[model samples]
Target: MELTVDERWDLIDKISKQTITFGRYSHTLKDAIAEITVKPLTGIPIAIAVMYGFWSFFGAFAGFFTDGFFVKIFDEHWLPWLQKVFPGEGGFLYYILVGDPTADNCFEAFGMLTSGLFVAIGVVLPAIIAFYLFLIIMEDSGYLPRLAVLIDTILHKIGLHGFAIVPIVLSLGCNVPAVTATRTLETKKQRFMMATLLAIFIPCGAQLGMMIEIIPGYVGFVMLYLLIGFFVTGFVLNKIIPGRSPEILMDVPPYRMPTVRNIGRKMWMRVKGFLFVAIPFVMLGVLLVNVLYWWGVIDWLADILEPVLSAWFGVPKETVGPLLAAFLRKDLAIAQLSAIEMTTYQLITSVVLINLYFPCVATFAMILKEGKEGGCKSAPIFLLGSLATLVATVFLFGGLLHLIWIILGVA
Candidate 1:
């Protein structure tokens, strides 16, 4: 006969009492490290150090590839070869494909075959590799959960659980998956808030890579500004949005050494995603921007937009093309932004606006797709919420930045 629950437990207890010897468990080195890393005073500094290492590695790896190696391959060898061999040197087809015959660097070339390929293959590819490599290592090592715990209190004030940092971190790589990741949030309010904040404020790895390529010195400033915007907007949304910001129980996993196979697999998948999703967009962005320029649409819009952009944003009219391209690919838009002549302040403002203005098409689609599935809010609420957040963030943050520059006499 099957024993009842109490009887079974009693029998198991008797058996354990008779047969099993209980030993005092010893705390291992991993346990000690975990304890140290999760505590507030220790963990925060460790987290900061880890992030600094991540940043240094990313910069060094991407710079070494883009500057040391690919710059030579693309700018010196590839551009000249294409400029010489491509037919109809000054014709529309030639201009669209090979860009400026006289331009020395791939960036200035602005062609599908030149800048598009170089930016996608050389610049962004390396950045994402470095980013994901380190991220995967951290993830596999089990430090991410401790990080989530450490950052939890700050995130709670913004209506997100500490684990919400996952999506934010992921958004650093790409927003499409980051938007999907919002589903991990327990509450509708949390998910919506996280998604909105990320799409508006977080630049993708490719975009960061391009920023590194174009404005490495100012990337830190831009990221800091965006971080401020993220928190500020999140605070407002938390206070105003009607919903429960509930506490979540975290399941922190044990620390383990990262294996090469797992790291390689995850990194390959991420880089592959970057390649397939990104390269086509880069090519398309170049093609479309060129077409718009060729058709006089850019010039037409520039005339209409110049007054508003110049007066309100302190950016130049030449930014119209990049702004248009930003919707297609923010990284490509920044690459294009770099080609335009502007002061450091204007470039900064323009790049920030480009990042804040809109989500790329893939990310937009993910928002629409992911919004329909979960929780208290319906799709309309989700979509409109994100759009509203984007609108307020872009104008408030964008206009405020311009005002700051003006105050500093930088504009």
Candidate 2:
């Protein structure tokens, strides 16, 4: 009953035509949204709006919780009680733990427990929670893919594809995870560039939170400067680093309502991880700075570095301690910097310097870990190369700001 191959195929085609029904399918709203969000013209504007909303929410939520609630608790109730109750009014332990006995607020206290706990729990934690919440919502709701597609071309200019945006955004929250996220990159070159640039350029959420709290007026300008440095440096690195900045085709999934349970779970897990890293480093920063200051090392270094700092960067030499603390945690360094007496412009410059000075301890270890996997470059070479690039960038960019300030009569 079986016919030859060609005859059987011809019979099947004839039968299929008669049996199968063809009909027009309607495009749903989800499909329409998917189309517009992936297209460049519509997607770019929407992406901008999304980011604007993200920032707005982050500021409002973090500010409300940090300023309206925690600031009061830390500054008024906790600090005064600690200052009064702790023994050894003029002794070392008192100074290290309770800070200035006469100081009225946590910001000026500059002690291991007072400022460290306040920055880690009160200020940075709120910002971390808010940032991760917004990010998770975007992820579960399916907007992240579109964002990746939207920015793919621009990112390619920096030797990264669209997916590279994951690490870039994550770096804003914490560089440790962000460095890990670089594994998703297709090549070692992209990983090295992304990790190194992020470590040097992008200030983490903790640092950003402190910036907002301490210098609300100047935060925007500082951020703009850093962002410009990020792209300009990225573009330059893309040119020199050997790699193929390949294009990516990402799927734009249909939008759906993100579940509250998933959002809460992810936010909690991230914040928990952050607390472990943030609290210890913040405490360590206070301990090291206090010990070094107690030992007069900071003073010696300040005296030695003064002429160069004053002449080149236009910041006070007192920033030497804060600069050292910046290696442990940038948020801690920024808090320390706020206690020092400085002009507004100097504060802005110092903040920028703290950002560009060095990556935190955790981030440094993470970079070292992820960097070794680079097939193109050895880990030691990567570390050395990154340090050299960082030194060059700090001098060039920091001095450029100093020069601009001089021109504007603000230096």
Candidate 3:
């Protein structure tokens, strides 16, 4: 009753500690999971293992949907029906819409309903579903934050804080929102660096899905190459860009069993986006590419960029079309790459380059907006410089990887 202020404050703190202890002890499962996931020694390895599982499942699931189901329907029903209705297979409109009916596969038959729909619905959509499902699970289960914690030291060495991992992970889903999310970063430098890294190296789920479909056994290698590029570019930018990386100060929420309703709602939002927004853009990309081809624009561009494409990148001149298409949509660009007949090395090289070159149109706009809002007056200059650096880095990295593969007798 006669206690001083300091004594009363001490008593209050003790009671608060007791309350917190009881609350924490009540969530035994959450604490147990955290003990493993947040420990320095085991955390990184576990995160890698989880990521590997995600990719493996994504590949298998997407493959089942694309090759087993969608391809069959497209080949057996959609293509034949379209050919019957629009009989002039060799006509200009038919060629533009349906591609070459005589082509062996839907991928080679570069038509809107044929190759485009097949890619968007069959290949990319399935991959998107798998990715979002996995991502949703991670988000619900609270593993993603632990992943950030696990990688925070490495990220800091490369000039990013742990919080940057949010955008990095989001970029895997889609770069536009990822770029928008850069607002969560504290400094202009961090945002710019993060955005640059994302645009350059993080292949969106759609693109990754297409890579999985097209390259089959080689998607992992491609991803590895891009990840290396990401770190290398980030390190270089950290040195070149003049700014201090802020420390990551974030709250790690409690782990809980994800409610089915919440998971379903989140999954539906992402799936709806893929079905409506992404698919239409993919079709538009296909149509635009075909129009450019018929108008001889693609040929002109290919000829103009032939030396760089063929000599520098080790890809054919036809790759210029897909490279250009990457600006519109990266997934569509990868789909277009499927039509080209090239060596595996060249295919890998092209995929690396596309991923490192630039973001899609939407992401590009978001980067600009974010830059301006963050008071970066020289946003365009920074972006151009970043693009130039990325181009050089990817070419060098791809060549080195190919050389190593050749030496190992894998190429």
User: What's the candidate order when arranged by decreasing TM-score?
Assistant: 1, 2, 3
User: For model 3, how does the per-residue alpha-carbon lDDT over 46-101 read when each residue is reduced to its tens digit?
Assistant: 88899889878888898889889998998888887777787786888898789987
- Model 1 residue 209 CA deviation (Å) reads 0.8
Off by over 4 Å in 2: 1-24, 375-377
Q: Which pairs clash in the backbone of model 1?
A: none
What lDDT does each candidate get? 0.91, 0.88, 0.82
Q: If both were scored by lDDT, which would come out higher, candidate 2 or candidate 3? A: 2
Better of 2 and 3 by TM-score: 2
Q: Please give the range of 10 consecutive residues that has the lowest summed lDDT in model 1.
A: 368-377
Q: List the residue pairs that clash in candidate 2.
A: none
Error of 3 at 250 (Å): 2.9
lDDT tens digits by residue: candidate 2, 1-411: 879999999999999999999899999998898888879999899899998898888899999999999999999899988987889987889878878888888988888889989999999999988888888888898988788888888887777888888888888888888999888887777888888899998998998889999998888899899989988999998898886766666766789899989988898788778777568878988988888888899999999999988999999999999999999889989998888998998889899999998788898998887767664458898888788879989998899999999999989
Clash count list over all predictions = 0, 0, 0
- Candidates 1 and 2: which is better by TM-score? 1
The TM-score, computed over Cα atoms with residue i paired to residue i, of candidate 3 is 0.90
Error of 2 at 108 (Å): 1.0
lDDT of 1: 0.91
- Scored by lDDT, the top model is 1
